[model samples]
Target: MAKQALGMIETVGLTSLVEAADAAIKAADVTMTGWDKIGSGLVCGFFVGDVAAVKAGIEAAAEAASQVGEVNSTLVIPRPHEELGQMGPWIS
Candidate 1:
């Protein structure tokens, strides 16, 4: 199997994260790893798939989340190092 890429979208609210997750899932063949709440209403959604698919998913997620609330940032890491998985369940 191809090494999975990781995609993340951070937003200011749960609603925005929900929107982001929806768009990400619908836009590409990605699996949602999970989500995290950073307190102060900040939330983040994570997805994993092929590099191209992850990049596409992140783009769609950011756009969709921004429409509903504040999107802080988005990231796509192609073939992230295995050690990253130790950081949290969301990274895998």
Candidate 2:
């Protein structure tokens, strides 16, 4: 498959992460690429798709997550570098 754009939203808790994930999928055509749980109760959701869709999805997710709890960070990479692919779901 061709390389896909990547989107991410990291929230304070699992429930918030789920909320973000739901909004992301609803707002755009994307697929869950990965999920991560970091210490101190941080939860991260990752999605991949077309550039525009990924941007929309991540933005929607961040907005939804913020409504629930603290949003640690958000990322939208239109065309992720090869190094980022190797990094995968890593929080660092």
Candidate 3:
């Protein structure tokens, strides 16, 4: 597998997460991995790609999500541990 970096963008709702994913993908060479719900109307969009691409993707996602709704958080994990990638939701 390629050396993938993981990006995550947390939004106030699933709708915002969807918009985040769309803009993120359009802005960078990244793939939407999946999503996780953290309750209380919080949802997170996951993406994986090259380190720089992941960073760019998450930045775009954050900006897009912030425009339509609230953005809870954003993160980019470059060269994430293999065990984390083995997690079910991280499989993409």
Candidate 4:
């Protein structure tokens, strides 16, 4: 099943954050849907082929981000459309 993981990271230095982000992206085997900087933090959007990939991606991103600053992450295992309702459309 497909999986998605979102990462929120706060960095003390911009250079470190950028470097970490670049490393994380390069390290990832999964597809990265999006990535953006918010203030002094970062938001990473990723899609994976399976649960294992999702977990691995999250761990990799966290490890890389920690080199720069603090990292916080959330993984969402989406349910069926009917269960998600409005959230389904947003995710898609």
lDDT by candidate, in order shown:
0.91, 0.83, 0.88, 0.49
**What does the lDDT read for residue 33 in candidate 3?**
80
- Give the number of the best model, judged by lDDT: 1
Q: With candidate 1 superimposed using the best TM-score fit, by how many Å does residue 79's alpha carbon deviate from the native? A: 0.5
Clash totals for all candidate models: 0, 0, 0, 0
Model 2 vs. true fold: TM: 0.86
Q: How would you encode candidate 1's per-residue C-alpha lDDT over 48-85 as one tens digit per residue? A: 99999999999999999989999999999999999889
Kindly report which residue stretches of model 4 are placed more than 4 angstroms away from their true locations once superposed.
1-24, 36-44, 76-91
lDDT of 3 by residue, 1-92 (tens): 25889888889999899999999999999999889888999998889999999999999999998899999999888888777856766544
Ranking by lDDT: 1, 3, 2, 4
TM-score for each prediction? 0.95, 0.86, 0.92, 0.51
Per-residue lDDT of candidate 2, residues 8-27 (tens digit): 88899999999999999999
- Candidate 4's TM-score: 0.51
lDDT of 4 by residue, 1-92 (tens): 22443333344455545554565556665554444455534444444434455456556666776776665554545332344434322333
Misplaced by over 4 Å in model 1 are none
Model 3, residue 42: displacement in angstroms? 0.4
